[model samples]
Structures are given as C-alpha cells and as structure tokens.
Target: MDISPTLIGFIGFGILLVFLAFRMTIGYGMLALGFVGFLIVAGWNDALGLLQNVPFHTMFDYDMAILPLFVVMGFFCYYSGISEDLYYTVHRWIGQIRGGMAMATVGACAGFAAVSGSGMATAATMATVALPEMRKYGYADSLATGCIAAGGTIGSLIPPSIAMIIYCVITEQSVGTMFIAGFIPGIM
Candidate 1:
C-alpha cells in the first residue's frame, strides 16, 4: 500500500509528539525521527549518506565554533567572579533608589551578555549573583525573578550572541552586521 506524503508527515509529527511526551530530548528525538523518515522516503543508502554528511557539516561549520567558546567564556566569567563583580558595580551605581536592585540586575545582565552571548548563561549567572542581593534588600520574589528573566533576554540581542550567529549562518547574513545592529536594541 502507498501512503501520501501528507499522511506520512502527519504520522511523523504524531510520533514526534509521542517521543516528546515520553521525555526524550527534543534534539535526539528529532534526529531519530528524521533518520527514520529519510529511510522511508529516500532509501537506506541515501538516508545513511544524509546521516553522515549532516553531522559532519554541522560540526565543521565555522559559526558553530562560537557557541562552545561563548559557553566557556560564561563559565570562566562565573568562576572568576567577573559576573558578580559586574553585578556589584552596577548595584553600587544604582542601588540607592527603589527598584534599584532590579535595574542593576538588568545592567549587569547586559554587561554579561556582551561576554556570554547566551540568554541561558546570562540568566543562570545573574540568578546566582543578583537574586540573593535583591532578596536581602526585601524585593518581591516575583519582581526579582521577572527582572532577571527579562534581563536574560538581552543576551540574545547583544554582541557575540549565539542565537544571532545561528540565525546568520542559516540565513546567509553577515554575523558582524547582525551583532552591530543588535547593540542599540539590546541596551534598551
């Protein structure tokens, strides 16, 4: 029996949902599902070829190099206390007024973003460095967490951003231009 491509797509999507529900990591699940789909749609040899080439190309891509470096830089910043120092410096500059701690969190996040370039890293780093200070000052939990979350998003817009690098690679855009363009909005 023959199956329409649309039906095959729906089946694949359903299987993906099942994989997700079963707590499989999305990356692995999608890779497995795509391999299976390729085996069905294109023969075994072609599917194997695709499996081999895709990973090779993805791993060797120049843009992909930046991701690991940024992550390591974030770790270095965290362990070396640079992120904490940034938070404290900003806090000192603005910690006198109401909601100042939250504002300082944002400023620190932006500074961290310049080095880290990943929102997750910025958020995690700031959570460790800023959360307790805000709590010590009697800031509400919701406000403190909200500010961190919002500030973390700045990493996606700042220079050296991993997200922008990935996007530039996929879209064939200039990474430097994208990073430069992100500065104004990222600061705001």
Candidate 2:
C-alpha cells in the first residue's frame, strides 16, 4: 500500500492547520512541517542542508536591515516625543489659516510617516497629536480624520519605507529606483 505524494502533501497541510489551531507558534510549526515535507520529498541530507542555509540567506539580506532600524527609530520617536513636537510646529505655522489645523494634521502625519515608515503608526501618532487641536478648532471630525488617514497611508509609499524595502528585496529591483518611483507619487 503506497501513499501518493498528494496524499502526503494534504496530510502535512492538515497537520499544519492543526498545529495552528492548537496555538503552536507559527514559525516553529511551519519549520517542523517544512522539514518533514522536505525530508519526505527529497532526503534527510537535503532537508538538513535547507534548514542550515535558509536562515543565513534570510538574515543577511540587506533589505532585512531596514526593518530593524526603522523599528528602533519608531521606539525612539515614541519615547522622545518627536511626534508631538511635529504637530505643534506645523500647528504654529499654519494655525491661523482657515482649515489650517486640518492641514497641520496632514502635514504632521506626513512628517511622522518619514520617521515611522508605517501607515498604522503614523495614523495612530497623528490621531493622538492632532485630534484634540482639530476638535478645539471646531474642524469637522470627518475632514480632520480623513486628512490624517490619507496622510498616514503615504508612509508606506514614501522613501525609507518598510513596504518598499521589502518590495524591492522580493522583486530584486534597485531600492533607490523604487524609492524614486514612489516618492513623487507619495507626495502628490
């Protein structure tokens, strides 16, 4: 009685789902199942070789470096309180203009986006920093929130962006070229 390759593949997939359902850590579960599948499909030597080399290739990639640096910068920005300063600075410069507070929200959001390079973080920071000022100025909630939301989304498309870094890595494109392509579109 021979088990077909498709049957083995389906069995492995089911086991992976069970591991996930049982709250096994995703990385470990995938690693375990992957080794088993590879061992079966190829051989023990090949499976072991794969396990040995994959992490080295994944870790040494230049694009992986960007994420950690940005993460560190994000923590620093959060603790050093730069986001607050950004909003206040924009507010002082634009507060007198009609709809200036909302404009400030967008401007500050874009500024913070440069530092955080994450849409969710930029939006969160802008909401915390700008919501009150916009409220105090009697700006409509929809307009104020909408501006921040739009501005925050630009973070992923702008330079020093995490998304673009990963994208360039996966696509084997030039990071500088990708950034240049995204920059003007992000700003506009």
Candidate 3:
C-alpha cells in the first residue's frame, strides 16, 4: 500500500492542472495538492509537521515580513492618486522633447515602481495613467506600449520589490542589502 514519491508528484501536478482549469487560485490549489501528495507518499505525521512548520518559518520570519508590507505599499500608491500625480509632473517636465512622452512614461513608471513593488501592477498603473496621454500626443502604438512594458519590469529591479524580498528570504540574505543592491540595476 505504498505510493512512490514520483507517482505522488505526478498526481499532484495533474490535480493542480485540473484545479487551474476549473479557475481555482493557483497558489492555493498547488499548496493543497502538494500537502495531499506529501501525506500519501511520506506519512501523516510528516505531512502534518510540514503543514504546521513550513508556513510558520516561511511567513513568521522577520525578513519575510517585508514582502507583505511592500505589497501593501503598492496598493497604497495606486489608490492614493500618487501614480497619476507623478505622471503629470514628469509629463509636463519632458512633454516637449522628441520621444519625451515615452521617456516621461518610463520616468513615471520608475517612480511608481518604488512604491508598487510589483512589475505587473506597476505596468498596469502606468498604462492606465500614461497611455491615454501618449495617445493624445499622437505617439505610436508600439512606442507607447514598449515604454509601458519596459517600465513595468523596473518594479522587480527596484527596492522593496516582492521578488527581491522573496529572494532575500529564500537565500537567507539581508533584506536591506538586497534592496540596496537592486537599485543600480533598476536605474539602468
């Protein structure tokens, strides 16, 4: 009555796909199925210990705490109208230069990236705030979208990013040092 670990893994993966197809949240589905597979392959005690301890260590660690804080900051920036203010200020400053609107979009995205900490969110926010303005100025489709896509990626490279925070936690590196390290690359 023993199941191989490989077989359990395949079953878990299959269930994960089925859950995803049914529109379940990917993280939750994978977590539940992973635990189920662990219980079947290892034993009830090991599975229970994993369920009890992994989340505690992963989330309760002080270094990992910054991850949720940065995520919240991103939402705060989005909701506080700061993203729009930044776009307008940068736009007015550079609107007259050749390709200035696109540059301004990049600048605004960088500014927002500091607070948002999420690339996709940063891009979506910048696109919403900057795209129409660029369109009004007769900017081309590819150029505007390109600026947005590029700018969005800066969130991960900048400080207080969820990705960076996760990396620091997983590698047991200093969160502050990692944040500082990301700044130079993010700017270029």
Error of 2 at 93 (Å): 4.1
**Residue-pair clashes per candidate, as listed?**
0, 0, 0
Model 2's lDDT to the true fold? 0.85
Which residue pairs show collisions in model 2?
Answer: none
Worst 10-residue stretch by lDDT in candidate 3? Answer: 63-72
Residue 169 alpha-carbon offset, candidate 3, angstroms: 1.2
Model 1: per-residue Cα lDDT at residue 35: 96
What does the lDDT read for residue 43 in candidate 1?
A: 98
Off by more than 4 A, model 1: 1-8
CA error at residue 173 for candidate 1, angstroms? 1.2
Against the reference, the lDDT scores of all candidates come to 0.92, 0.85, 0.86
- Which 10 consecutive positions of candidate 2 have the poorest summed lDDT? 70-79
Q: Candidates' TM-scores?
A: 0.92, 0.76, 0.85
Which pairs of residues clash in candidate 1, taking residues 3 or more apart in a chain or in different chains? none
Number of residue pairs clashing in candidate 1, backbone atoms closer than 3 angstroms, sequence gap of 3 or more or interchain: 0
Reference-based TM-score, model 1: 0.92
Model 3 earns a TM-score of: 0.85
Please write out the lDDT profile of model 1 over residues 1-188, one tens digit for every residue: 99988998899999999999999999999999999988988999999999989898989899988899999999999999999999999999998887788999999999998899999999999998889988998988999999999999988988989999999999999998998898888777
Candidate 2 per-residue lDDT over residues 57-160, each given as its tens digit: 98998888778888678668867889898889998999789878877888888888888888888898788778787888787888888988988888987777
